[model samples]
Target: MDFKTVSTIGLESSPVAQALAGLRANEARYFWNKYKHEFVTEPAANNPAIVARVNTILGERDTHFETAPLEVSDFEVAGVR
Candidate 1:
């Protein structure tokens, strides 16, 4: 299986980028070792569907948050969405 790197665009200047990158690397490593599949990610700005879904779910629960996500990831296998 091929491994894909996670996207951390706007997070470059963030103090937490290192930690987040480590976490993403760990997740990718786990998936590669166990399922032999790649873990991929993209900037949230590039994935409108995911952002809409997340906001919809939050709206359903009447929950509101101020911070918007800078990156997004979707995990899928066997044609599942």
Candidate 2:
């Protein structure tokens, strides 16, 4: 399978950004091999609607991440959102 290269442009603030990117790449490879799905990420700032939707979803549990979300993965896996 051909793996798509992932970008770490927005993850600069994280201390282990490169490692995180590598881990994401590994996840992409795994998903591609197992489900033939391509994992993609978008800069959070570029997609406010997605971010707001995520916040609303998280509100159901009264749990929210305090750190700024630099990027987000917005996709369905096998028809599950």
Candidate 3:
């Protein structure tokens, strides 16, 4: 498959494209600097396990995240979950 940069695909309909892009770049930088690992993202619909894990954690604290996430990144960084 051909690699696609964020600039080359999507974002035309997003009003906060600039901010979202900045956040994405920040995530990449943090993971790279802290763990020397590449950041990864996948559609939330395809990753029920990740979603369930997050919800379970929040449930323990009785906290709720009202908005559903459109994407998910799952990985351990430097022994931290």
Candidate 4:
């Protein structure tokens, strides 16, 4: 299929797309603790409690990101809102 058609294909109904989507998610969080966890912290040197809260939010977002539905429209690279 062409790139335009492929880009719009609904992932939920396509096994190939779904598997690819899942693989991307797995790769994204392969080192979630190492890469993503750090970004949760703000620029300011906050207290220990604030740091902990940031970690908690990052953990939760990672969890939900994997379990969420595979929607091609939701992931449109250029037009994502």
List per-candidate RMSD values in Å: 3.8, 2.8, 4.1, 15.1
The residue pairs that clash in candidate 4, if any, are none
Tens digits of per-residue lDDT for model 1, 1-81:
122555455568666886777677788887778777777777888999999998999999999878787677787766655
* Residue 61, model 2: Cα distance from true site in angstroms: 0.9
- Indicate the TM-score of model 3: 0.71
Off by over 4 Å in 3: 1-18
**Which candidate's TM-score is highest?**
2
Report how far off residue 27 is in candidate 4 (Å). 0.9
Q: Rank the candidates by lDDT, best first.
A: 2, 1, 3, 4
Per-residue lDDT, model 1, residue 81, is: 50
User: Which pairs, if any, clash in model 2?
Assistant: none
Residue-by-residue lDDT tens digits, candidate 3, 52-80? 99999999999997667666789887789
lDDT (0 to 1) per candidate: 0.74, 0.79, 0.69, 0.39
Tens-place lDDT digits, model 4, residues 1-81: 121122323344545765655554554443343444211112123354554554577788874333334331111223432
lDDT of 3: 0.69
Deviation (Å) of 74 in candidate 3: 1.1
Collision pairs in model 3:
none
| Backbone clash count for every predicted candidate, in the order shown | 0, 0, 0, 0
